[model samples]
Target: MLRSFSYLTDHTGFCGTIKNSPSDFVVTEIEVTEHSLRDTQAKSLQKPMEVLLGQSSPGLCAQSCDGGGTPVPADQGLRWAGDSCPASPCQNQHESKAELKPGLEDASVLDSLLGKAVSELLNKYACDLKDVWKSKSDANAGTREFSLGPILDKKNRADLHSAIRQKFPFLVTVTKDNEMIVKGNADYRELCQFVTEKETSDFFKFLDAKLENSTFSFEPDGDKEHRKVVHHFINRKFGKLLETKSFTVTDVNDQQNMSIMVRFREKGWSRKRPAGGFQEKQDLYTAFTLQKENLETLEAISFLAAELGVLPSDFSYTGIKDKKAITYQPMVVKKVTPERLKEIGNKMEKKGIRIHNIHSACQHLRLGQLKGNHFDVVVRDLKHHSHDSSADLKKRISEAMENVETKGFVNYYGPQRFGQGQNVQTDQIGLALLNEEMVKAVKLFFTPEDTDDPVNNAKRYFLQTEDAKGALVMLPEFKVRERMLLRALNRYGVNHEGCTKGWLSIPHSMRIFYVHAYCSKIWNEAASYRLSIYGSKVVEGDLVFSEETDETISLNDKVHVVTAAEESAKKYSINQVVLPMVGHSIKYPGNKVGQWYHERLSKDELQTCKFRVSPLQLNIPGCYRPILKNVQNLSYFLEGSEKGIEIEDNYLNESKVSLHISFDLDPSCYATVCLREIMKCDF
Candidate 1:
């Protein structure tokens, strides 16, 4: 799937050892709460001490208010509503529960509850985080926040909690009835005690003591089903043990869960690939128990970015990861010292986080965040309906590709999606498009259009009679014009308008020439696509390379028809030499002349062709050029001129292909356009 090349200059490779290997640094202080879980059960009398003052307790911090026995002014009440009091406040103390006002049940409250639940639900979490701080003599481990979404709807919160308890009772406590009371013996004191328990305290204290070693570790139960137990410990301990630090731990396999049976191989650690993988592995850095999230990947990057001293720009990822799918992505950070990396890892472990391993990477790793992610997705629950079959799905995909262009679907580098954890603006995409277009336009002029204008001393040639009569002028093929264009490109810089703005001779070199030619090709291709879409005939239309010469007679007077082969030849001749001929080739006097002769004689050579700038050109600069094959486009069209075949057809016909793929990913990433190469699909 990935390859590397070693060249003479150095041990080189293409898509080499994935740069920016995913860095698993321990972050402290970054805590994320699962938004939805089962309703919490109140701490029983015996569990009271453990519930309060415990790292994994229902983090209920209370503030006493003058419990005015009489209904205080509604304005002075704690903003909760209930059945006993119409549109009332003071936390709705009816004997049942506090019902939030219609839109007043803030997301933050749910978030808080979820955070509290995350601690209470997982015993290891409670032990590592709670005990650390309760036992102040022990140093704190770091903290890390993780994210879980689709916060439970208030109605479902209870059921979800129950399910959670059934699955992970040690992690959470489920209640059968509401226990919030604002009056009498059932007041704030009970609530306060319910949250700060000795169990939670001891948990945090344990992590704190563990942190003294500074090395982190994940001791997952190799059994896949029990992985969640490991992650539970990691998250809770990290949150409670470390006074200030954040970390993220992710599994490196499908189910991209946060759980792991990861144990530090202190004795077996070596700089060689692990049993199943092929990387220069290293010693397991830290160790601790872990639990899985039963979802997609763990977004360690976001957590690290927010908690550690990592800048948004400091990270690049390969895939637009799935938050629910347990997946691991290569990570990298620049401008940071090893000490810093170690410090971060240590801080994380001190709080109950375990760093499975840490080894130096030669290059930075990115999660394919650029150019968007590549995906192969498979859909389930597909019905074989006579009306809605796989064929229909394929048809829908094909149809969508032809009709509309999605706006928000930007042509930006993938990292743009996480714009500093902000939103991407239309203006940025627009600028990127514009810049690409201009670059392409420049390249186009360098190759095909460069020779349009004559060298003042050169004999300006023309095919005299231009009266639109079936007149064909195959004078010297398309290469002559292409050379001229290449020459012109060498001499002048082409602007967006396709006009020369400045001049440069072969004195400089080919790099500039390449840049110029590449840009122009992009611009022309964009234009050509637009023209084809608008019902224009580029197939047989007047393909002109010009400083318009007055034809002895106007061609408009008659219709001109030319062979497709001639058109192909001309297009090839003009663009072929633009990119490859410059600098040293320029130094050779007859190099251009030789190229001109070679292209004119070779009727079989295929070349890329395009017109001036178009919108799409703004994204991918460069016109279609002569190449062995355009694999990306071949699935739909007859690839190159496979022998000299001629067709008198008036229009290009549509051809379709069937495509099916399956994808497994972390959340927050989509497969909208990943299948473009196979079949264009957009909605």
Candidate 2:
């Protein structure tokens, strides 16, 4: 889709082109430091009790509560008291059944307070817990409630409740007017079953049985959202029990989905503590400054991973820099020694990548773990307006720069987010993934356009003959995803399952790119519409982060919607107004802008609620982005001969001007979008 740019400043924009060469677009990441992290942690510790207690707020946390008690360590496992082992309600119900009988004290207390018949019924209900869990849906399986007929004596109810708690710690009990209510925790049951099944089953009989010393992959049977939920459930409940790496994978339906590979962690893994108080000490991670020219961040990392003999997932960076740029950023690698990295750095330097300033870090770098990026861009082949002299042009450009510095520019995502050329767009593939049209997404991703490259030829060959092995022979080694997918197709057959297995073989980050690009498209359009309609006005229902909130916290929990009273009182400024990126969790504006979001989403056959892909375990819990971003340290100058400059053709001579511009943007802000505002021309 063609992107529309809306400007916040009314000043006329001059025409220019950026990123003519790799050196022309320079980027330097402003990385987060130990001091900043300490400050953030301190602030978090100081949060009000109410905010800390209110965990249900949007974006506060995704994992469900473990029922408000000390979590049992994974290694300790659940212990069943011998006395509490109850007989199964039906002997032939299932080959294996859970034993959930009350202890002697529990039975005696219940029998004395509520009679033998009532106690027997409770025991029978508890015995059927396993069957109930296996039969119920995820939503209903999470919790089960049982109501005991009301007893007149309050003391007896209290005694019964205490006895049940001792026998079944997973059960929560409450008494209301002598009516004792008992509820079973699903997470508790799941954990117990997981441990029991693993212990009882033959180690050599499972799919992961042979993977004793290596990570074993597990593909949950569900959509993306459901998969994600399951992943979180596993992480929260069994994190100590297993070390897992979760990534996007294609399912049998050829749809983007989630899968996790797990391996047994060392004994007492959960007991290990994180580095505390920023004390200088040796660490497992090596942090270094990485400088690269004309290479995408992932491409450089992939090359480095090959040279280092490590997986790409072992390395982490603060952000993805522009592919066609001289960029410097901090990168962290786990378990790799600095000395070893320095050895590889020499080889990498020949490929336009340089590593330096290596040091030990307590933790690995995460995406967006940076303050912002400083840009030194050179806008070349500037075209002046008709009849405008160099002086007039200079004057216009200066005013435009000042206008942006004061009023800011619309924070639209850059064109690179959507991919280049007139072929298939990344967002199109992403939309297909979101719409659960896996076949279409797969085709859009793997099916080559009418390009004459060898890779395209290979793809065409594969499509025509369904010969993955033949295509693999012709495809270049650098075509990682293509080669990997073909191998999977060859092994699994050229079918839906094979296609999904092919996606699973590719890197997780690459798979997420398409979905994120789709979100970026919606964001860019929404931002344009916001600026076009509001024109820097902060209206009622406009969302803004609270004054005390850190802008770095890009979640809905800290977001506050402007009330009519707040708007009338002029409490928020235009810069504070933010727009949603279209997700299931975000709140839309209450006015026409909000209505427009729904309408636009509907056009794509999407709703805010449908942003989640349950089968793929992808949850697009959208976050808010500022509609306007202030230009920091903005400055510019024009360069070029007055006569004219020779164009690329060498024959055509045009009066070309180059505008050298420099600025800093907050992390996640697109410099190209900012340039679009100054030049007022699509690159």
Best by lDDT: 2
Per-model TM-score versus the true fold: 0.22, 0.63
Error of 1 at 294 (Å): 14
The best candidate in terms of TM-score = 2
Assess candidate 2 and give its TM-score to the true structure.
0.63
- The clash tally of candidate 2 reads 17
Q: After superposition, how far is residue 135 of candidate 2 from its true place, in Å?
A: 38
Distance from true location, Cα of 569 in model 2, Å: 3.6
Q: Candidate 1: TM-score?
A: 0.22
